[model samples]
Target: MSDPVDFRDNRGVGTLISDLIQQVSSLMQTEIRLLRAEMGDKLKTMLGGAVEVLAGGLLLMAALLILLQALVVALAHWVGAGWASLIVGLVVAVIGVILVKRGTSNIEPSNLTPDQTTNQLARDAAVVKEQFK
Candidate 1:
C-alpha cells in the first residue's frame, strides 16, 4: 500500500497532478483489498457461528424428542421418574436456545459490517484532504 502523496517539490503542475491521481488510485485499491479481506474474515466467522447454530438446533430437537418420549413412557410407570426426565430435557433445551442465540448474534448485520475498514478509509480521505488544504 502506498502512502498519500507529499507534494513539496518544485515539480510541474501537470506532473504533480498525475502523481497525486496515481497515489490516490493506489490508496483506493489498497483500501478495497483491505475491505475484501475484512469481509472474508467476517464471513468465515459467521459461517462458524452458523455451524454452532445448526448444532444447537440439533440439540434442541433431540431435547424435545427426549422430553416427549420420556414423559409418555415414564409417566405410565412413575410420577417421580417423569418429573426428573422433564427437568433434564428442559435444561438441555435451555442450553440449546442459548447456543442458538449466541450463534445468531455472531451473524447479525451489525457484527458483519466492515466498520474498521470503512473507518480507516474515512481517515485516509481526511488526511488527503488536509494535505490539499
Candidate 2:
C-alpha cells in the first residue's frame, strides 16, 4: 500500500502554488508542441495515402479505359456501336464517381486530432486538481 502524502512542508503554500503554476505553464507549452508534431505526422501520413491513391487511380483509369474499350468493341459487334458506347461510358462514370473514396478515407479532419496530447492534458489536469486538494 502507498503511504499517505505529507502536506507539511518547510516551503510556504504560496511558493508551492507559484511553482505549480510555472510547471503547469511549461507542461502546457510542451503539450502544444506535441500536438503540433502529432498533427504534422497525421498530415504526412494522409498526404502519403493521397499520393498512393492518386497513382493507383491513374493506373486503374488507364486499365479500365482499355478493358472497357475492348468490351465496347466486343459488345458493338453483338449490339449496335451507339448502344455499346453509351453503356461503357455509363459504367466508367459510375466507377469513377466512387473511385477515390477508399484512398481518401484516411484524410479525414478527425484523424488530425492529437489524441496523445489530449490524454496527457487530461492526466495533467487530474494531477493539478489532486495537488490543489
**Which candidate number has the best lDDT?**
1
Q: What tens-digit string does per-residue lDDT give for candidate 2 at 46-128?
A: 89768757865775676577567767676668656645655666665555545566557777777777899899999989998
Ten residues in a row with the worst lDDT in model 2? Answer: 90-99
Candidate 2: stretches off by over 4 Å: 1-4, 72-102
What lDDT does model 1 reach? 0.90
lDDT of 1 by residue, 5-95 (tens): 7667889999989999999999999999999999999999899889889989998998998899778968698767777888889988999
Q: How do all models score by TM-score? A: 0.83, 0.69
Alpha-carbon local distance difference test for all models: 0.90, 0.76
- Residue pairs with clashing backbones, model 2: none
In model 1, which regions exceed 4 Å deviation? 1-8, 79-84
